[model samples]
Target chain A: MKNIIIASTSTIHGSGYLDYILEELNTFFKEAETILFIPYARPGGISHDEYTNIVKTAFTKINKTVKGIHEFENPVEAIANAEAIFTGGGNTFVLTDMLHRNHLIEAIQNVVKNGTPYLGTSAGSNICGLTIRTTNDMPIVYPPSFNALALVPFNINPHYLDPDTNSKHMGETRETRIKEFHGFNPQPVVGLREGSWLRVSGDSIVLKGHLTARIFEKGKSPCEVEPETELNTLK
Target chain B: MKNIIIASTSTIHGSGYLDYILEELNTFFKEAETILFIPYARPGGISHDEYTNIVKTAFTKINKTVKGIHEFENPVEAIANAEAIFTGGGNTFVLTDMLHRNHLIEAIQNVVKNGTPYLGTSAGSNICGLTIRTTNDMPIVYPPSFNALALVPFNINPHYLDPDTNSKHMGETRETRIKEFHGFNPQPVVGLREGSWLRVSGDSIVLKGHLTARIFEKGKSPCEVEPETELNTLK
Candidate 1:
């Protein structure tokens, strides 16, 4: 059975890194003594070592050691040998570009599907979808392809925010962007609000958290689904 | 000599479509009797005819006729013979994809370089840069390449927003996103606020509109430049 926790973000507002979800992660990663961290996203252009150190500090709270894939000679081998894997948030395009360039996409996908416990937050969670078409991040760098792990049947719009009726900004809302994605893409999209996550076990993908998630399908009106809902039925 | 007006948006809040810039546009396109409209962006997933009709109504006020390039049997020829060209805002990925698919990138570049009057708003303005790497739009579709017109020396981040100091949202601020772009891209970027534009006349690119534009250059602190400032010195 596949075990995974795909979170909208690692840190919520007014919270430390991964602090809000540390309790759940303690149980999720209980089986593993160490986690192999993929810090390719490099949020805010932080160095790989700096990014990995941050993840290490967070995982330490759960009594688990963390090591960055960059420290290994072969990333594919690192994924294969990892007891558990945790991919942190940053720029999705940068993360995807590095994942493709380092040939870790298939390696990571194979291990995750073959029963390795996995955790993905933000940009990391984005790569678990069918494609990165629904990401809100700016396209700082172009990847070889928009194709992703296909770990889930649908795409994810992380940090999903609803339209503020009082705001004067003219930019497209998170919902509008997803609708635009549906115009060209056929996959269903989950607008994952902060503090929300999808718990995947075997063939079951259940939404978890107190807030509701906005579900978007091609040619259909977007609807809201409550927590504990089965998202695998979206397709 | 290049004559172009690259706007941050087509409409400001509480305003009709192109209402604010119509007066300036009237004087800008005084020499042209007809405007060839490229409605490939398709904001809100509207059809080409519908998007073109909106532009037609706006241009009619200036005593100019508007025809969508899609109406032509040969789009390449349509660009070569047009008196003036206008590309409106929508999804940047969609617009870039169509521009590449129809092989109009080179055609548009040629005509514009040869002194064809050009106007681009939002996604259209995005294409006038060196690459579409700084766009805020979601990657609804993959284009053949990120390379753009290179009409100006630097990239343009249209509809630029300032960071909300009081918001609890954890999403990356606009400034942070642009800074992230600079991490990978060496080109300077202009954050053109709503109602702001870049007026390109020959080799001089001047900031227009009342609002001050934010300027971001690689490895430097972002600064604000007042309207009418010449942006050609960015590089």
Candidate 2:
């Protein structure tokens, strides 16, 4: 059985870092005394220690200690030994590149699958899917491959926004981009709005937040699924 | 001498395809009788013929014929003998993939460098940079490399948008994304607003439009440059 909380974002608008989800996290990480943090995403080019400190501050509110994976001699060994793991948000390309370069993809996947509590937000949640093709982050760095942990059955488009009718911008909308992704990819994609997350326990996956998620299938029109909807059949 | 028009977008808000820039294009491509269109980007998953037809309809207004490179038996040879080339906007990954797959990168670069008129919009314009790392498009497909045409000295972030002060969305702003790009890439990047373009003639590259373009160089604050400002010295 696997235990995970895959969120669309770490900090929602007008909220402190992970403040909105602290209550849920308190329960999600109840079994663990310390969390192994992976800060490789390095948002705004912040150093690993700086990012880890941010995570540590947030986890402290719930009485859980946090340590960055970089602190360990071997990241693979750290993941195997961790009681719980939390990966924060940043540039998906950089996160994926680091994950591949460190060869931590399988180590993390294996432990998470074996029931080590896990939490991922934004770029972190992106790697929990089948591939990083749906990530909104720029290609700041090239990873060895687009393959991800495949902890979930389909791909995830985090920080997903609906089309703004009043906007004058001509760039492709989030819906249009996912439609374009389907042109080259056949896997289903879940458009996860901010404050929303998927709670995975064993083989059951359910939408946990108040907002509805937009589900996109290859040949069908995108439709909104209500909160608490089971998503394990999304593939 | 190279004569190229690299635009941020082919269609701006509330406008028909290429309507805003057709007048300028008439003079820019005056000597070319037919324009070779590269429809590899395939916006909305439209077929090559359909995408080419869209371009053909727009070019016909300027009294120019348009033929897709896919129409030719050999895409590389098609670029070699073309009087002019036009690569329209779509997905950058797909566009770069096809360009590399058909071995047209060097062919197009050679012809453009020798004064054959060339035009690129959005994804097309993205390829004129040294790499596709700055593109805002989703990575629907993996290309062989992020390396691009290198026709220009710096990368281009087409459809550049400023931070929305009113929006509650917490995703990284366009400026933040570019700033993150600089953390790894040393090259300067031009944030081209819609309706703005770069006019490259020989060794001189000038910004051409009514609005100012944002220039982002590594290790310095981003600044706005006036239209008609020379950009060739940005390396």
Candidate 3:
């Protein structure tokens, strides 16, 4: 059985870090007294200690204890013994690299497979998918491969933004990028927008947010699913 | 001597393909009657033949011939004999992957180093940088490495856009992303906005266009460099 909260972003507009989702997190992690935080992504280049402290502040408001994975001598052991795990948002490339190099990918996935609760935002959420093929982050570093945890059947494009009709920029739109990924990959993808998240409980995964998510299939046009929609429809 | 046109994009807002830069390109490739095009980036998932034909149409207006690398029996030999080279914009991951897999990275760099005249727009221009660490494209595929042509001293963030103050998205801003890149890598980067480019001649690379280019250094605050400014000052 698997239990995870994969969010498109940690913060929403006009909200503090994890403020928008703290209520849900408190319920999702109610069973755990102390949650281990993986701050490898280091959003905006903050140090692991610094990033962990931020997550700690969020968990404190929910009456839970938080500890960074870096605090432990062995990261694999840290994940193995953790009551729960949370990976914050940052550069996906660097996060994936650290996870692979530290040999914690399998360790973390193993714990999650046994139903250790997992929470991931943005870059962290990207790794829960089949591959990190649809990430929008810059390739600041190269990992061994794009392979990632198979916690989910498909990939995800977090913080998904629609094309700005009035904008003049000529860069490829997010949809075009996902389509390009499909051109090379067989995996379907979901464009998870801000404030949107997926709640995975064993074999059941449901969209649990106010906004609708854009689902992209290999050969079909992108379609939208409303909040609370069952994601098994995608499979 | 080196001759290169590293553009921010192939087309500007409200312009035809390559229409904004055709005059400069005509002057840049004045000595060549036919130029080789590397359409490996495959912008918007278009095929090589289709992308090549688009380039052909643009070159036709300047009274020059265009040929894609795929059209040749030997890509390496084609590069060695190319009068000039033009690599258009698309996905940087795919572009870099194709260059490395086909063993054309060094071949193309060699000609550009020896003054064969080169034009790179968007993804194409990113290769001229120290690394493809600052590209805005999605990681649709994985390349063997992040190492690029290193024709220039710094990396480039092509089609760079300023953070929209009114926007509600919580993803890292472009500036934040580049700053994060610097935290791991020491290389400085230039955020080249659309319609701006660097005109490179032997021992001289000057910023050209009406707008300014944003320069980001490892330990210093990012600043704007004036149009027609010399990039050598940053180096």
User: Which pairs clash in the backbone of model 3?
Assistant: none
Q: On residues A57-174, what C-alpha lDDT tens digit does candidate 1 reach at each position? A: 8877888999999999999999999999999999999999999999999998899889999999999999999998888899999999998888899998899998988889898988
Q: lDDT tens string, model 3, B9-114?
A: 9989888999988898889989999999999999888899999999999899999999999999889999999999999998899999999999998998898889
Model 2: per-residue lDDT, tens digit, A142-172? 8999998899999999999999999999999
Residue B53, model 1, lDDT: 99
Docking class of 1: high
Q: What lDDT does candidate 2 reach at residue A217? A: 97
> Model 1 — TM-score against the truth?
0.99
Instruction: Compose the digit string of candidate 2's lDDT tens values, residues B1-235.
Output: 9999999999988999999999999999999999999999999889999999999999999999999999999999999999999999999999999999899899999999999999999999999999999999999999999999999989999999999999999999999999999999999999999999999999999999899999999999999999999998899
For residues B15-91, write the lDDT of model 1, one tens digit per residue. Answer: 99999999999999999999999999999889999999999999899999999999999999999999999999999
Between candidates 2 and 3, the one scoring higher on lDDT is 2
Report how far residue A123 has shifted in candidate 2, in Å: 0.4
Model 1 per-residue lDDT at B15: 97
Candidate 2 achieves a global lDDT of 0.95
Model 2 share of native interface contacts: 0.87
Which segments of model 1 are wrong by more than 4 Å? Answer: none
Model 3's DockQ score: 0.87
Alpha-carbon shift of residue A216 in model 3 (angstroms)? 0.4
Who wins the DockQ comparison? 2
